[model samples]
Target: MSRIGKKPVSVPAGVTASVDGQTVKAKGPKGELSFVVNDEVLVKMEEGSIKVDPRDDSKDARSKWGMSRTMIVNILLGVKDGFEKRLEISGVGYRAAMQGKNLQLALGFSHDVLYPIPDGIQITVPRPTEIVITGIDKQQVGQVAAEIREYRGPEPYKGKGVKYAGEKIVRKEGKKK
Candidate 1:
């Protein structure tokens, strides 16, 4: 028996879960997400919980049973609570500001870099040097954050660039004299 697969996924308030053949859909306040689980994994919706059961005892079926359950659970949570990533500018004159739907970044370059924020992702500037990324889908939020951070990655010498808040950069000595 798979422990994780046997666990019951509780239905939270304002969240609805429905199983249709091989696909499962979860709807919450933030948004709605659907996942098509493996055919070998038998998913059943009970009174207020969803259960995943594998049709076979094979290794592959057992693994998929648990994996599919976890994926579906994450989608449910994501639609209910969402996800957020916070980033900060770490240079003398590096800063970020919201210009309409675009992010204006001044990263000690000759000209400011303008990054157009993607749809379904929200960018907020709590402070001049701080950036907050929020969205329902974890993958999209992370991808957008990575793209922004790549514009001016943290440097080892001066540790100047865009990075996640509280991230540590290993500073290196300029030269060996």
Candidate 2:
């Protein structure tokens, strides 16, 4: 009785979706993406919508049913509108810039950290302290942002480093006098 799996995922007007065996593919104006549903889950198209169900009543099957349905939904939405992640650098000399097809970061380091942009993903620096990552795949976009943030994560005391936009950092008290 997976509540989310019971709900069908509708294909938007401009997006096309197909389910072949365990693989679900979607194509839209943004781009194309696909997800492979687990064998424990059964997927099919019903009246322009995708439906998912567990193959059995076992715990594993039921667990995968909801996850598979969410994965299908992610691809459909990904291909339709894409995804974006924003990172902010908050140090005195920390900044980000686009160097050709790579992202150059100055996170209070002696040398600039050069991160090569991957294919199908776009990185833009609207401002020196702001980094925007966009891609058709939600996972890739999020992974790229995480990798960049790992270079110089925000500290608890001063919170001087790179962090996600609107992320709240828990500050720690400074050394007592």
Weakest 10 consecutive residues, lDDT, candidate 2? 69-78
Tell me which residue pairs clash in candidate 2: none
Candidate 2, residue 36: CA error in Å? 1.1
Candidate 1 residues 134-153, lDDT tens each?
Answer: 98877789899999999999
Q: Which residue segments of model 1 deviate by more than 4 Å?
A: 1-3
TM-score of each: 0.85, 0.98
Score each candidate by Cα lDDT. Answer: 0.89, 0.92
- How displaced is residue 59 in candidate 2, in Å? 0.9
Give the best candidate by lDDT. 2
What TM-score, to 2 decimals, does candidate 1 have?
0.85
User: How well does candidate 2 match the true structure in TM-score terms?
Assistant: 0.98
Residue 50 lDDT, candidate 1, scale 0-100: 88
